[model samples]
Target: MLTLQRRQLVGHDILLARHGNHISTMRVDRQAGRVVAYLDDGSVDSAPNLITPGLPMPATVRSVLREDWKFFAVATACTTGFAGVMVAAAVALAGLSGEPGMTQLLSAYSGT
Candidate 1:
């Protein structure tokens, strides 16, 4: 970013020539809702411009997934271990057999 002379600054709608006569793009001012750029005489311009690069799904989601993947794996592992332990305990301690069903237990606990 080139900083032109402050004397050359103008109003909020100060024009900036990116290439030729036409104003290609305008940069917004940070402090106010004005613009920042160069005018015909050359100066710093500013405005309240918002540029959206669009949603980067993979880039953004990757960070969130990376941060949560460990917890997800741990949760899944714990759930699997809990289910295994429950089945084992039922079979061994309770001497339960015949499909070792959990429908009744699951249904009763689900309500509670």
Candidate 2:
């Protein structure tokens, strides 16, 4: 079994466990169900959570969007729809006011 310790100041929960004689400090993410141990060899490895019982490991998401993709897609569609509506309203308002002739532009281009 792994002994759990919380370092609130560092915002990381450290997990300590003994393999044979040497005790290792590791980080246990209960949400992702992942245990990252800093080995004495200076190599980091994702250790198995089997050492920590009563902890159910869930699927880990690599990115934020990968977790809730459906919600993200809906939010994007809603924002795009709102922007399209605003643009449509502006175009309608402009059309209703009628077109303004560009007299200065026409004169400048025609060299009049």
lDDT scores in order: 0.51, 0.54
Q: lDDT value for candidate 1?
A: 0.51
The total number of steric clashes, by the backbone 3 Å criterion, in model 1 comes to 11
Return the lDDT, model 1, position 38: 56
lDDT of 1 at 99: 44
- Worst ten in a row by lDDT for model 1: 1-10
TM-score of each: 0.31, 0.39
RMSD of 1: 14.0
Off by over 4 Å in 2: 1-15, 19-47, 50-65, 99-112
Each model's backbone clash number: 11, 0
The best candidate by TM-score is 2
- The deviation in Å at residue 89 for candidate 2 is 1.8
